[model samples]
Target: MNHSRAILTLAWREILRFLRQRNRVIGAVGQPVLFWLLFGAGLESTFRLGESGQSFRDYYFPGSFMLILLFTAIFTSISIIEDRKEGFLQSVLVSPVPRWGIVLGKVLGGTTLALLQGLLFLSFLFFTEMRPGLFEIGQLIFLAGIAAFGMTSLGFVLAWRLDSTQGFHAIMNLLLMPMWLLSGAFFPIPSLENGSFLLHWIMRCNPMSYAVSGVRQQMDGSFLTADLAADYWFPSLSLCWAVTILFSLLMFSWAWKTSSRRVQGDLR
Candidate 1:
């Protein structure tokens, strides 16, 4: 098969598999809404948005959207483990397709699912009192797609090496969950009085921090506000986009490398 055809075939299969699973749809789209309603409402009064006087729910809108993308990416990538066990992956490995095509197909499949769910979550913004202009809506779509691509690629890399879905879950909870929490999705980077310099450094190092920050910047156009932008400790919007794109490329390369190594080892 040609490279493009191989990629499309794999991606189409993933999309069909995802659509056939009703529970996956509910879990991907429903849980994020539940979390937003429950946690966001609970914290709205207690957690203020700096001096802007915005409620936590308004501030958390972007994060919740990111959560949808993250969850979808996680579940979609986990299918790799199942495919491996069922010998489907081995069949693909032995096919005439390039390893990069396989990686692109899988990553793009997960990314497509993530972006779809993330956009669905966007419809809830009206209830949250957020009405983005046409330009802002476009920006949200662009940023959401980029974030989903990078995150799904990251999950692909992890799932590519794993043998079990349970193991993927454990590692995801340990890695992805904390990455979200620290990405300023749930809370602002803590003040020095309430947090440590090390914690601040860690947040800066997290690539997802830029993803979250990029989404926030797109949604609110907060980059125009100098003081407000500085308060949150997120990178600049351009920086966020650059870092996120770099991250996506790096993760895609890593997954391709890992898959190539696996194919070589199997031949040996």
Candidate 2:
């Protein structure tokens, strides 16, 4: 079969598997709602200004959507390990398709799945008054697609070395928590008291920090208008897209190298 056909067939099979077991899809779309509803409601009255003037709900809602994309991407990576265990990898290896195509197919399929969940969440948020504006809604969807790709690349790397579900989950959890917390997804990064060096470092180093910042800029209506003239802004959404694409490429390269090394038993 042609590489394109192979990828489409694999992607279709994965979508069908998701349909047959809709719980995973439902859960992926549901948790974000629960967060927006429960957590947003609880803190709606309390959370305060991070210089955006958006209320707690407004600020954190985008973060919740990011959370959904993050979770979906990493979980989808587990399919690599699953395929290996189920003999699916053997079938793919026998095919004429390149090994990179196998990884690319999985990433495309998984990221598409994540984007679907993201759209559903955005739709829910719009209808519920948790968010507003048709343009903003569309922008959110676009950003979600970007986030899904970034996450899928990260997942590819995680699964490349992880042999067991437990190990994958552990490394994923470790990576996920720090990335999420440090990215200003849950709380304001600049608001952190100048006492903790480690948190300050993590906040500076995490790339997710830029992503969350971008989403927050959109949510708070600060994209073109500078709230703080000194604070670095990407200058345009085009830059944001370029930055994300570049970052995703770097991640894919790293993950591909890791996978190749492991396949040759050059890495432990």
Every candidate's lDDT? 0.83, 0.69
lDDT of 2 by residue, 1-268 (tens): 4688887777676667767877887677787778877877898888755354556677677788788888788878887787777767667766788766766777777788888887677665553334446786677567667777778888888887766889998987787867887776787554234336666666756777667766665554542234432332222455555666677778777766665544521222
Give TM per candidate.
0.93, 0.84
Error of 2 at 87 (Å): 0.6
Clashing residue pairs in candidate 2, if any?
Answer: none
TM-score of 1: 0.93
Best by the lDDT measure: 1
Q: Candidate 2 has what TM-score?
A: 0.84
